[model samples]
Target: MSTATLPRTRSRSRVQAPKNPRDYVRIGLWIALAIVMVIWAMPMVFVFLTSIKSEADIFSTSSFAIPGAPEWQNYAEALATGNLMTAGGNSLLIALVKVPVGLFIAAAAAFALSRIRFKYDTLILGAFALGSMVPIQVALGPLFKTILDMGLLNNPLGVILPYIGFGLPMQVFILHGFFTQVPKEIDESVRVDGGGNLRLFLQFILPLSKPALAALFILDFVATWNEYAIALVILQNKASQTVPLAIQSFQSQFTSSYGPLNAFTIMSILPVLIIYLLFQRYFVQGMFTGAVKG
Candidate 1:
């Protein structure tokens, strides 16, 4: 009776080991990536280590080693003596006003270029695309002089306007690509319901384009936050200086406030880091959204 029936059990698959030189490439790549990551992170590690140490320990101990005790006062000293507070406020004001305003304008322009067919759509979009290639330095003098003549120099408007203007080209370019990828059927459907271009943009395009907007917003915010050359040129009033300018002036004036400088640098970067973390989920998605049309 036992010989008449048989039960089958599944055989386990054997694990394969690397058998040739090329088979070891994956391991080599992982090692190389780890090494590169360590190298990339070393500077930040050094800065953080230096920021926590007293000036004495900063110089006495290994640059990457932990401090005997954290010199937390360095942050306070930096905040007190440095123009960081004013500069930070100015930076915040500029970014807050500039990012949303700039993104809206860019998104509108992109919508017009991508969704609304016009006689010169290609020409206009190409012009903006080309503008992104022009060096900011090329316009620096003209921008400064225009701001000076308009009595806006050393004012928040000067920074905000230029930021919006310069930020537009790239933002529009990005949004245009994303906008084109959006189904024309949506626009046609909206128009069939008696919607105009404005309604189409606000109600349909914007809601669907949040990731693209977030990605662009984060990038533009970082650029505006850390802008040095333009802010240095336009924002001459120490009271109106931005973080980059404040850090520059701080370094030049103090010369030896290494710990405070490091602390200030840390503090300055936190906002951008936080913003990145908040929007990071959309970052890769938005960046590649326009890459292919499927």
Candidate 2:
């Protein structure tokens, strides 16, 4: 071959590593995530196994042991019980009645705070924020007395009304942030186009705030559904008790029998979980949307 045109002569080759180091960092993150997920999932798995076990197998088996054969009977027992069925019915009814009332009140309050300037706005907002953080234990005595005075003490409405009241402060706080993020021009433009406050709110504001609304509804539903302590206090009648109240009574039986209790416990969690999952996208989006709005 001609000297200049000959195939290039081989020289000692040196290998250079990939320039980006992020590959290793990403791999490490995935590994950490996997470990965390496994750790988190262990308890859920244990609960499922426990639900299937007969009362005899609960303590007899190793604490972390899985059931050899899953018995589906426990779910039937829990679901078939008169008290639980009543409780579930009561909870569903309360949530149905209470959610709209809660949302309406919370949204209206948030809209006022977000859009209108007033002398008491900041003060009232602060009050609501502070009230929302107060531990429920502080209000128990007066609340019980108030419920009794209303003659609704032992019914689901007793619990539902209180849920709305106690739930409002946080709901307003959340919604206020979301509302403040609303474009001011949208409000002014609506007014310019002959829309009043109610029209602007119902036609424009509420539609734009649907994500926040959905998120709030789902959260309130879950919180009200799973609330055991206050429900135990207000709902005295087993026949009219909410789900959490029923779950409490289930504990008494579970002290002697685990099968039905675990099953019922799992049953109680499902509705809340489903609510969360169903609204999860909107929930997460609303959280980010409001937080970043400033």
Candidate 3:
């Protein structure tokens, strides 16, 4: 065979690695993102680690290191000692009752403000928005007195009623923005079909505003669940205390410990986290839609 015709094979294939400035920049960005993720995750990781550690280990060992044996009983002890089930039940009832009621009233008001075009519309909205700016602390004394006058102190209804009233401002504000973004043509079409405001709101408007409603409900649930000051003040009886108050009991004037408290905290956050995750897509969409449309 002729030398030129003979088959030639290379000993190795040359592979190129990233060498461009943009490629290096991409690599730098990935590294920075990873660092940020680690930083953000550390607190959550520490909480879980500390919750499963024995008190002795927690005090003797480094906060960053893992324990040899996880104290799963810490959760059980925390639950029993905190009376978490009762607190959790109270919180759940408040959320379930208040969320729907608040949403209905807010949605109706929002519909009137945005669609009906009644007199003093802007003035009404501004008044509600003003409530959002007023700190809860400012209202606590008056609210307490009102509850006392009404003979509702230490009652679940007291909390529920206040939650419904106080939660309305933000819910109305958000739903109004969402309701405004909805086309006017739809409302006119419904009216032309002989639909009244009630039918139109129930059949059309509420269905269209599910994302905003879910987002608002999730926010309300979390806020209501974690509320401490108002619950502490109003719920003088231990039986009516909510989860935040239960968590507070983990510390007393003479002694303070965080292991069992951390465990209860994790349990307390689970419901909120699960609900948020379930509705996360809608929540994100609702939030961004309100921002862009309004």
| Index of the highest-lDDT prediction | 1
Candidate 2 residue pairs in backbone clash: none
Ranking by TM-score: 1, 2, 3
List the lowest-lDDT window of 10 residues for candidate 1.
Answer: 17-26
Instruction: Tell me the tens digit of each residue's lDDT in model 3 across 1-294.
Output: 655666778689788876853778889999999999999999999999988998899999999789999998989878877768998899888888888888899999999998887789999999989887877888899899999999998888889898888888878987888898888888889889999889889999999998888889789888888888788879988798888887776555214557777788889889889889998998887777756534
Name model 2 segments beyond 4 Å from true: 1-20, 23-29, 291-294
Candidate 3 similarity to native, TM-score: 0.85
TM-score of 2: 0.86
Most TM-score-accurate candidate: 1
Stretches of candidate 3 off by over 4 Å are: 1-36, 253-256, 290-294
lDDT (10s digit) by residue, model 2, range 53-113: 9877887997667778877899998787637777888888888889889999999999889
Model 1 regions more than 4 Å off: 1-33, 290-294
